[model samples]
Target: MWKTMILLVLVNVINGQCSCSKFTDESSCFAYGYCLFVNGVCVEQKCEAIPYQEKCKSPLCLWKDNKCLTFKAAESTCQTLLPQQCTEYQGCYYDYTNLKCQISNNCSKLEIDQCNGQLGNGNSCIVDPFNNKCQEMTDCKSLSTEFMCLSQFPFCLYQNSSCKPSSCNEINDSVSCSIMDQCQWNNNKCEIKNCQSIKFGYQCNGKTCGFDKDQCFSCIEQYGYQFFAGLISLLFIL
Candidate 1:
């Protein structure tokens, strides 16, 4: 009888040790240090088992509400960050003067080196001849001179003494795309190329691309075609 009682106790202990999913109550789940109550179910905890927020440090996890949660880049935005936490997230900048975390839209405030950082969002900095200040360029039609239009080549084209929007496929020559800022000659067609494709440091033009440790890199890759369309719409509104 004692042997049977001992066998039953051993079986119960083994079952309790392995039965995290059987826990239906939050209190019971919390009692187990290795178990987590998530989405109305109890499961084995990994990063969530971290007791302190400061102790939670992993690229895959983010600390929130004193708990370590999975990091999801798509769910995050630049607007919902504190000034101190702004620069820590990708594609976010902290403006000291305004005391805000935001994606910078005003190209005029940026220096020459910082100008093309906004290129991914359909904004570029150009020297305004009238004011002699670096200003944002959103519309090719705003460019008064051919020299100004050609300088923004691939994005803007000079034709009929006027500047107009130029797509990558519009350029037929390989040489023209090779020398231009944002274009690459690939498969006998002019195509948009990111900074990573550039092999040499000399090929990294500070305008649309940057160089670091003999490799070319872009400032930001968050913005896409939607941003360009929005920029054109904004230009028409202005």
Candidate 2:
């Protein structure tokens, strides 16, 4: 029985399923088919094999370097290679440029004309779909919401007309709200808040307050007349 036990242990070691506690480095673990290197240790990870086409998705095409590689392939390669592989399909193409690999039509020329402007002015321009001509870009200040601004231009305006994403310690006003609906200016920074169905003259935050004017007035009175007098005057009418 002891000899049989010893043989089983030797077989397990030969199969590369032995514990990696003896090894300190990742390379030793990798040599045994362990894929995860974590917190100064190597461990076995469960990986499910998915189909190449579904795993790649759109703008992401599979290419053969040696094995199948899935990433954003070039327009020329995507349209040519993928179409030939499956005759039933209209063929796939990488949708975006830069780092992203999306499957869509080529809009590189149209985007270039819009950004640089066909007329060659420093002013940013975009294709006006109505006229099909490049038109000068509008400022975030001119637009009502951040979504409108970003939808039109690449960036949105800050409190000082500076273009940037809402970082720490920014004011959450109408302009900021338009940029991202989920964030609110709280404790000197943009924070996630529930501003939906906000009651008049009441600050919107995570918690819901009663819409009843009497209860609201009673709560406000505790803070003193000078603090909430204006708020009471506005919301008390309803």
Candidate 3:
């Protein structure tokens, strides 16, 4: 009777062990995803869920732009584009209107200025020449100098220090040079003169002789000029 009881106890223990047993040997492991069953007992890595972090998106998508960053990192990024102010958040770049991160702005970087004149060095300043004020544009398109001409009131030195044509009507029709670097105020009218063309501009006859205006004006007709500039627009295309 005792021997019979022993056999029954062994069978129960085996059944219990087998209930959660997994494949331990290679052949058995192949049967399962990657489980291991040893001595009719399971020995495998338990599956657990990884907690999600609100601050970070899944690493799968890949960084089109790493604007979704930590506070410090976001600050640094904004400083590069907007020197005036920068706010921070997680999962997207700083937004001006809402002042929070919602989605990628696909930052349009405008005014990557060195701030040499008034904006300051290593800092960028968005220039609104129309209103004669400065704003800091961030996450913007490429920073470009617009050379649109604008009319103005007479005798008033423009923010750019040039006298605009007098307009009798309320509508101002000031026009600016296409090439900003080459345009400046000379006397009372706008003029085109710069390092690249200064040597050429000063001496119309050529540097071999002294500076000449008539020859220079003639040459300027080929290249564009400012205000009542040369007549290049009237003739040449290239």
Candidate 4:
């Protein structure tokens, strides 16, 4: 009776251990759509049950033997792919709307006026210049620059029947300006310019520069050196 009970317990433990599907390599795990790695074991990865936001946009589908294959998010490695390719190749990408691989021709060309209608009410979309697909707009608060906002939200700076990039002058607070790396706010605008682009001018950011900008930065950097040097000289004198 004792031997039989021990045998049953061993069998139960083995069954519990073998319940999860195993893979020797990560590649095999991914190929089988099992991406979770736990305790040196590959386990099934559960995709979040998020609803699809829009119809699949296409023309960026992967080509094999001259045929465009629909993107399969689960089967394809999307995060590993370059973001630049997502724009350059048009639809040869896994559609973020549905999290699936899509063909380039699957997406229809959308205009600025039609973009908002593609997404849910109150949600907006941008018509990408490369593919003309109506991409859903990201929240305005999460964005830093007007150019990026315009790319994500086509209607960001609308005027004269056209959309334009937002300017740093639109920022209302010092914190927002600092977050944008515009250390100095002047004339109600983020006016610091790129120092390297102009002679003797200090670069405030990538595009703007200020004459006083370089002097201020130079003083700050030298302040530490000057302090250390003065301390050393005082020690020698003493």
* Candidate 1 lDDT by residue in tens digits, 1-238: 6555555444333222334564567755554435567798977666666665653543334577777765433324445555565545433445556655556556677544333323334455575555555566767988777777888876689999999978678899998787655677888998876778888766755345544445565543323456545555654554
How do all models score by TM-score? 0.31, 0.25, 0.19, 0.25
The sequence of per-residue lDDT tens digits that candidate 4 reaches over residues 110-218 is: 4433333222222334455554455554345433444435554322454444445344565565555655433345556554423334443223222122123133121
Relative to the true structure, how large is the alpha-carbon lDDT of every model? Answer: 0.59, 0.37, 0.30, 0.38
- True-structure lDDT of candidate 2: 0.37
Name the runs in model 4 displaced over 4 angstroms. Answer: 1-94, 101-156, 160-162, 174-189, 192-238
Q: Compare candidates 1 and 3 on TM-score and give the better one.
A: 1
Determine which window of 10 residues in candidate 3 has minimal summed lDDT: 114-123
Tens digit of lDDT per residue, candidate 3, span 116-219?
Answer: 11111212344455555444332122223332222112322233443333222322323433222234444455554422344553332221121222222222
Which residue segments of model 1 deviate by more than 4 Å?
1-105, 110-114, 119-122, 129-131, 167-170, 175-238
> Mind sharing the TM-score for model 2?
0.25
Considering summed lDDT, which 10 consecutive residues are worst modelled in model 2? 213-222
Estimate the TM-score for candidate 4: 0.25
Error of 1 at 136 (Å): 1.3
List candidate 2 segments past 4 Å from native: 1-72, 80-108, 111-148, 152-155, 158-162, 171-238
Clashes found in each candidate (C-alpha, N, C closer than 3 A)? 0, 6, 15, 25
